[model samples]
Structure formats: structure tokens, C-alpha cells
Target: MRNMLITGGAGFIGSNFCHYWAEKYPQDKVVVLDLLTYAGHRENIQSLENSTSFAFIQGDIGDQALVEKLFTEHQINCVIHFAAESHVDRSILGPDAFLQTNIMGTHTLLKVAKKFWLDAGVANHHFHHVSTDEVYGSLTEDAPAFTESTPFAPNSPYSASKAASDHLVRAYHHTYGLNVTTSNCSNNYGPYQDSEKLIPLIIQNILQGKALPIYGDGKNIRDWLYVEDHCRAIDLILHKGKIGEVYNVGGENEWRNIDIVNLICAKVDAAVVASPELLVRYPHTPCATSGDAKSLITYVKDRPGHDRRYAIDPGKCHAELGYHPVESFESGIVKTIHWLLHNQRETVNQ
Candidate 1:
């Protein structure tokens, strides 16, 4: 049985991957390493405690000694690197954490993996790095989507750090002969996602009867991948993908930021049984007693270096690994809204 080390396994996509792996590959032992940062919550993967196939450790990936120790003790055969400072706004406010975690932490993992795998004479070992499509920069209205060959032109500090890590992983493969694969995915929205993200933020605002803040004119576009679909694509890449190759995973469903916010407002209002009038604190706000969540939409000043659009061409992943998303934007948004409401209900009940 293989020993898999999943960094940042307590975060949204990473925790979902932990659940998926536990159910699909029960024979393999899973070791999750997370530093319990603000974005990483242990409760996200608490369900794994009942399973003999999973283990969680609280530690930083940048700690070379700890990482090396885990690799040596567990005989780790695969590394799924997901620990990174992911929020764009946070990165803009302070890029140090992004650089430290995404770049230096990745370098640390690569160093340890190369040393342990080579010394153990482990064959067929794989190292998979999770990344974002923002590394390709922005796309215009008529421009084609980002492909594996897209030239790197990262716009934000967060994307730049991820790009650096991606390059390091590629370099390790070429120089050290380490089996490596990378997947640059589009924006993901689903259950267990931090409310700071677009979809969940909108949901939380609607529930609290607060203004649904949208940056700029709210016309910015992004390809929205369901979190579970992303997990499945990563699984396929780990098993079927060729060594030293990069695959782009996308939802193939593009939506403008404004349109998605509007969709969530409508869905949440319809799903929740509470009276809209009672939820609102100020009647002058957009969210009055009209039972319309769209009333809450308020445009604000846009942040610096906000990419106009991001889209990914996943033709290679589909053709090479037969990857196809099971959820469309329409269906996925509905699921996300329901999940937030359900969680909110559970919290209130407790």
C-alpha cells in the first residue's frame, strides 16, 4: 500500500480530497500535514478520525526537519502539495506569507522528497503540485482560454508566488529525475470552502442581510470549477498522467462575477424559509423586504491588479485522462448555496 502525504489537507479542496481518497482508496495510508493557519481548520477533516486509512499532523511544510522526518518515517510514496497562501486580497496586503509558504515551503518539500525518495530507492513515486490559472494572467473577451502552453504573465502577488512554486517543481523533475505533475485549476466553489471566497461570501452576506459587495463593476469573469470535480481531476492526473507534464483542470463553465452573485442571491432567498424583511437591519439597503437578494448587490472600488478574466482550456486533460466535470455552473451554484445554509442551520441548532 502506498503512503500519501497531503499537505494543506485541512483546507477546502484539500479536505474534500481527503474524504474522496478515504472512500475511494481505502487501502492506501493517508498522512495529512497542515500548519492550522487561519484558512486551515481541523474540523474540516475531523470525520477522518474514524478511518484507519487517514492521519493528520499539525506542522509547517517549511520546517525541513519535520517534513524530512515524516517522509522518512512514513515511507511516503506520493506527495500532494496544496499548502499555500491562496487569497489574492490577503496577498496584496502582505506578500510575505505568500512567498514564504508558496515558494519557500514548496522548495522545502521538493528538497525533502528528492532526498528521501532517492535514498530509499523508491520507484514510480509521484509528486503532484496544485496551482491556479491566475499564473497565466488575464484574458480578454475574445482571447482564447489558458492552455498548458500559455505563457506565464502572473498579475497578482499570489499568482506570482504560485508560479514560482510551479517552476520549482518542474525544475526538480528535469534536474533530479523526480516524477512530477502539475494541475492549474480555475476558481473552485463548493462545500467546506471558507466564506472569504466569492460564492460563499455572497451566501454569508445574504444570510446576515448585509450588502453583497462586488468589486468594481462586477463584470470580471472566471471559470468556476466545482471542488469535487477538481478533486477527481487531480486523482486522474496522479494515476494516469505522464511524468513531467502539466494538465489544466477547468469547469469549462465561465460566469461573470456579477452574474454569479446574482445567482446566489436568488438561490439562497428561495431556499431559506426566513422572512426577508425580518433578516434586514436597514430597510434603506438593497436587501429590503422585497424577498430579492439582488437588492443587496453593491458595487465598490476595485482592488489593484484584479485580473479582468480567467479561463482554462481543459481539452488536454479530457483527451489525455478522460476528465469531465459532473456539475455545471448552474447546478454547482445551487449546491453551494444549500451547503452554506445547511451549515448555518446546524450552527444555530448547536
Candidate 2:
């Protein structure tokens, strides 16, 4: 492709994809459009400032007139859609924004892209929609991973909205012969990620000697994929996967919530050589108990509509695109902790 448009490229995964695509295809022009909401950060792609092949536009993908204008003015040959309201807790507090940006926003972009593709002809363009495994709904730990054929049973407004957008994308491909491919991926953790999510939240709180809260019994499980690996999988699917097909991207890394927290504590302790910034001990707090960070464990009420488990069956992408995750949970977790350590320190005085 000569020119590509990536919506929400300032957000976590989108920003990673932008860097991935720019470096992979240096000759192509890459434009990033984002609304710069709370989760979208300009600093993520700040390093791209001097790259002539990269450009950033501050705007919402839901704006119809703006989307049409981009299609016409850029002569965009392909689109990688990543914009959406993604946090489950945020969606619970405000469902309207989720519906507007996730479903309606995707619809508007797809419509404009369809018109452009038809005018430009078929063989040279594509619309790659990035989505989440949450769209497959929660599953029991004993249940098999959600495959491409898994039936949708979204439990939260966030996942439901994504499912709605997925359906719209499917309809466009089937009814209009639009070349489309969708990927439903598991949880992603890496640098430049917003701190509101679970991993970063735990890192921030634990580092500050705050309680490491886990909801309910903390048995909820999720397959975690490193952001870089996820971007690699998306790149493969975009260039090689079949049209009108959905692929599942997973790391095969699963851990119980409490286990993850405890592991983080151990790793942080091993990594820290100096006294913590803040550590309160009830004068009588036993040295043995106070020394271990796990003493700060606290359980809260379970989240409303929280999924019990989510795992992805990536056989389709593995067989077709020859994709494989490079990091094991142990290795990935260490790298994540190191990055969090350095990043938290970097942002401390900012």
C-alpha cells in the first residue's frame, strides 16, 4: 500500500502498530488520527516527530465529514481501525460514550472506507479491524479457548459494543464485497499503556506501598499478549490472512489475579535495593510480615459483570499466517516489570 490510515494510533496498541507499520514499510505514508481522549497520549509516538513517513491528526473517527475528507484527501489505500472506548469500568460508568465511539464510530469509518475502496478498485486495498477477545464473552476455566467460530455472548457494555462493531464489519465484507479482516486478541501489556488498566495500576500502587487490591477472590484469568507481539500478529494478518475471516491472537499465557500480584511483589522486591518511598508499619507490625509486600493485599467487591475467564484459540492465524508468540509468561513478566520500574521513575517528576 502507498498510503495507510490508522485510527486511534495515539492509543496503546494503535501506537505500537503505527511504529510497526512505519518501520516495516518505510516507503509508505502512515497517518494517525486520534481524538486525544484520556487514554490517547501524544508522548507515545513523540519519537516519530522527525520521521517524514509519519503524520498525526487530532480528530475523532466518528466524525463523518472528517472521515470522508480524509479518504478523499489522502488517497488512502488501506485502513487499520483501532479507535474505541476500551475500559470496562469506564464503560460501566458511561455506556453512551462506549456505544458512540465503539459501534457508531466504527460504522462511520467503514462506510467512508467502503466508498473510497469501490471508487479506487478492489485488488489494492484492505480494511483491517482490530478487536478484543472480550467480544467472545466470559468463559469457564475448564472451557476451551474461543476460536474464530465461537458464538458471541458479551457480558459488559464494552464487549457488547465491540461485538456490534464486529458485526457491522462482517456485513460490509459479505454484502458489499469489501476486503476485510478482523482479529480478536487477548489482553495486551507493554510500554506507553495507560495506567488505568490492571497491570500498570498494580505497578503504581505497589511501588507507592499502597494496597494491591484484587476483586473478590481474585480468580479471574486472562491470556496476556505483549503489545509488540500483538502488533506483529496484526501485521501478519493484514498482509497474509484471507478476506472476510476473523483470527484470534493469543499468548497462551494465563495466570490467576492473585498469583500475578504476588509475582509482581516478589519481582519488585528482588529488583528494589533501597528502602521503599513509603512503607507504613503499625508500630507493632511484625518485621517478617512487614518485609514482604504481599502483606498489603486487599480484596474488594467484585466488578459488576466481570468475566470469569477469557482465552483465545489462535489456530487459524497460526496455521495460515505462521504466527507464534515469542515470549513466555515468565520472560514477558520480567520485561514488563523492568519497563514499569523505569517508566514509573521517569514519570515521577513530570
Candidate 3:
């Protein structure tokens, strides 16, 4: 059985991956290392605590001592590195944290992995780095989607830092012979996401009858991927992907920002109508009180260096690894809404 270390396992995508992995590979040992930052919540992985094969450690990936300890204790042979300062707005406000965490932290992990796995002559270890599509920068309305070979043209501090980490992973493989694979994914939206993200923020604001803020004209587009599909893609990569290769994982479901907000509003409205109990739970919602949730849409100034569009071409992954997203945007959003509705108290507290 594979003994794995999953960094940022308390964060949205990471936590979802942890749950998916634990369920699918119960015989394997899973160790989670997270810094418990603003976005990472212990509640996300509390359910996994009861499992005998799972362990959670509250720590930073940059802490070399702590990382080494875990690797030694757990006999970690596979690492799914996901811990990074991921918010673009936060990165714009404070770029230093992004550099420290994304670049330095990744380097530290690479160092530890090399020492323990390569220096020790372990031939079965793998390091998989999770990254974002923003590293390819913006695309014009009709430009082709970003492929694995897309040159890095990162626009913001966040994407730039991610690009740096991606390069470090690649360098570790080519120069040091580290068995590594990287997957750069599109915008992911699903359960357990922090309220700061667009989809979860919109859903929470609609439930509270707060203004739904849209940046610029909200025409900027992003390809949305269901988190579970991403987990599955990574699963395939771990088992079958070529070493030292990069895969672009995406749902291929592109939607404009305003259009997504409108869709969520409509879906929430329909949900409240279908289940009257939701009206009682979220009485402040415009949808619950004979008003459309769309009435609360509010436009605001756009952030600096905001990319106009990002889409991913998953053709390589499909042809090579048979990777395809199973959830449609509609179904994924519905699942996210339903999850937030039941877990609103926990979500708001987070």
C-alpha cells in the first residue's frame, strides 16, 4: 500500500482530494500536512480523523524538520503537494507571503523529497505538484485553450509564484532525476471551498441577502472544474502518467463571471422554491421573500493584473491517461449549493 503525504489537505481542493483518496485507497496510509492558514480549515478534514489509515499534522510545508519527520515516520513514498498561498487578491495585497510559501515552501519540499527518496535510493517514490492555469496568463476571447506546452506568461504575483514552483518541480526532475508530475488545473468550485472564492462567496452572499460583488463588467471568463474530477485526474496521473510530464486538467466548461453568478442565483432561487424549508433557514435571502437574487448584483473595481480569460486543453490528458471530467457545470453548481445550504453555519464561521 502506498504511504502518501498530502500537503494542504485541509484546504478546499486538497481536502476533497484527501477524502477521495482515503475512500478509494483505504489500505493506503494518508498523512496530511497543512499550515491552517486563513483558507485551510481543520473542519474540512475532521471526518477523516476517525480513519485508522489517515493522520493529520498541523504544520508548514516549509518546515524542513517537520517534513522530514513525517516522511520518516510515515514512510511516505508519494507526495501530492498542494500547499500554496492561492488567493490572487491576497497575493496582490501581500506578495511576500506568496513568494515565501509558493516558491520557498515548494523548494523545501523538493529538498526533503530528494534527500529521503533519491539519496536513500528509493526507486518507487513520486512527487506530484498541483498548480493553476493562471501560469499561462490571459487568453483572448477566441484564443486556443492552454495546453501542457503553453509557455508561462504569468500576469499576477500568485500565478508568477506558481510558475516558479512549477519550474522548480520540473528542474528537480530533469536535473536531479526526481520522479515528478505536475498538473495545472482551471478554476475549481465545489463543496468545502472557502467563502472567499467566487462561487462560494456568491452562494453565501445570496443566502444572507448581501450584495453580490462583480469585478469589472464581470465578463472575464474561466474554465470551471469540479474538484472531484480533478482528484480523479490526479489518481490517473499517479498510476499511469509519464514521469516528468505536465498535464492540464480542466472541465472544459467555460463560463463568464457574471453568467456564473446569475446561474447560481437562479439555481438558489429554484432550490428555495422547491424546498420551502430553505426559506425558513435563510429568511434574509431575496429569493426567499419574493425578490430575485439577481437584484443584489453589485459591480466593483477590478483587481490589478486580473487575467481576462483562462481555459485549459485537456486533450493530452485524455489521449494519454483517459482523463475526462464527469460533472457538468450545472450538476457541480447544484452540488455546491446544496452542500453550502446544509453547512451554512460551519461555512460562515470559517
Candidate 4:
């Protein structure tokens, strides 16, 4: 059984992955390291705290000494690096944190892994870096989906920092033979996601009757992947991926920003109509008072350097690793809305 060190395990996609891994491989030891940043919450992984195979540590990934200590103590044989300052708007406002965490933090992890796993002659260790598709920049409507060979053209500080980290991972593999693999995925949506993101934000706002803000004309497109599907892809990669190679993971589900908001409104309205108890729980919602959730839509100026479109071609991952996403947007969004409805108290307080 593998002893895995998962960074950013308290955050959105990371927490989901932690649960997925722990449940799927009960014999393996799963250790989570997280800084509990604004987007990271303890409650996300609270259920796994009592599991025999699970452990949680509140810490920074960039702390070399702490990392080394964990490596020695846990006998960590695999590193799934997911920690980062991921919000594009946050990065635009404050880029220093992104650089420090995404670039420097990743470098520190590489150094510690090289010393303990490579220099110390440990065998069968692997490093998997999780990244995003924004590094490929904007794509015109007519442009084909981004392939593995697409050149980097990051337009925002967040994407740029991720791109830098991606290069570092590649350099570590080719230059130092660190036995690394990277997967750059498209937009992910599911339970436990931060409310600041588009999907969760819309859900939360609709529940509270707050404005559903759309950026620009809300025509920007993004390929969406369900969080569990992403975790499954990573599982396949860790087990079957070629070392030193990069794979693109996507759901092949594309939706425009405005369209996603509208869909959520319709779905939430339908839920409220079917279950009147939801009206008691979220009394302020438009649907609670015979008003349509769509009435809350409001358009605002777009953020600077906002990419027009992003889509991933997962052909290589499918052909080589037998990876395919099972959740369609219709079903995935339904699950997400249902989760938020049940967890409204905890989700809104956060």
C-alpha cells in the first residue's frame, strides 16, 4: 500500500480527492497537509479524521523542514501536489502570494522529494502535480480544443504562476529524474467548492436572493469537469501514467458562463417548487416568494486579462491511460445543487 502526502488537501478539489482516495484505497495511508487558507476548511475533511488510514496536518507546503520531517515520519512514497493560490481575481489583486506558493512552494517540495526519494535511493516514489488549463490562455470560438502540445500563453498572474510551476515540475523530471507527472485540467465543479467560484457562488446567491453577477456579457466559455471525475483521472495517472509526461484531463463538457448561471437558477427553482421545506430554510430566496431566480441576474464589468475560452482535449489520457469522465453537466450540476441545499447552513457561514 502506498503512503501518500497530499498537499492542499483541505481545499475544494483536494478535499474531494482525499475522500476519493481514502475510500477507494482503504489499505493505503493518506496524509493531508493544508494551510487552511480562505478557500480551505477543516470541515471539508472532518469525516475522514477518524479513519484508520487517514491523518491531517495543518501546515505550509513551502516549509522545507516540516516537509522533510513528514517525509521521514510518514514514509511518504508518493506526493500529490495540489496546494496553490488558485483564484484568478485574487491573483490579479495580489500576485505575490501566487508566486510564493505556486512557484516557490512547488520548488521546495521538489527539493525535499529529490533529497529523500532520489538522493537517499528510495525506489518507486512518484510526484504528481495538479494544474489548470488557463495556462493555455484564450481560445477563439473556432479554435480547436487545447492539446498536450499547446504552447503556454497565460494572461493572468494566477495562470502565469501555475505555468511556472508546471515548468519546474518538468525540469525536475528531465534534469533530476524525480519520476514526476503533471495533469492540467479544465474548470471543476462539485460539492465542498468555495462559494467564491462561479457555480457555488450562483447557488449561494440564489438561496439568499442576492444578485447573480455576470462578468462582461457572460459569454466566456470554459470546459467543466466534475471533481470526482478529476480525482478518478488522477488515480489512473498515478497508477498508469508515463513518468515525465503531462496529461490533460477534462469532462469534454463546455458551457458559457451566463448559460451556467441560468441553468442553476432553473434547477434551484424546480427544487424549491417540489419541496416547500426549502422555502422555510431559505426564506429570502426569490423562489420562496413566487419570484423567479432568474430575476436576480446582474451584469458587471469583466476582470482584466479574463480569458475568452478554455477547453481541453483529453485524447492522450484516454488512449494511454483509459481515462474518461462519467458525469455529464446536467447530472453533475444537479448533484452540486442538492449538496448545497442540504449543507446550506455550513456552506453559507463559510
TM-score of each: 0.94, 0.93, 0.98, 0.98
Give lDDT per model, in order. Answer: 0.88, 0.85, 0.94, 0.94
Q: What is the lDDT of candidate 4?
A: 0.94
Model 1 weakest 10-residue run by lDDT = 277-286
Model 2: lDDT equals 0.85
Model 4 spans with C-alpha error above 4 angstroms: 345-350
RMSD, model 4, all Cα superposed?
1.0
Model 3 lowest lDDT segment of ten: 341-350
Q: Give the root-mean-square deviation of each candidate in angstroms.
A: 2.9, 3.4, 1.2, 1.0
Please give the ranking of all candidate structures by lDDT, highest first, separated by commas: 3, 4, 1, 2
| Candidate 4 residue lDDT tens string, 173-292 | 999899999999999999999989999999999988899999999999999999999999999999999999999999999999999999999999999878978888888889888999
What order do candidates take by TM-score, descending? 4, 3, 1, 2
Candidate 3 clashing pairs, residues 3+ apart or interchain: none
* Model 2 agreement with the true structure over 60-145: per-residue lDDT tens digits: 99899998888777888889999999999999998999999999999998888878886567567889999999998998989999
Candidate 2: misplaced stretches above 4 Å? Answer: 120-122, 274-290, 345-350
The digit string of per-residue lDDT tens for model 3 on 285-310 reads 89777999999999999988889999
Query: Residue 283: error of model 3 in Å?
Result: 1.3
lDDT of 1 at 155: 96
Q: Summing lDDT over every window of 10 consecutive residues in candidate 4, give the lowest-scoring window.
A: 341-350
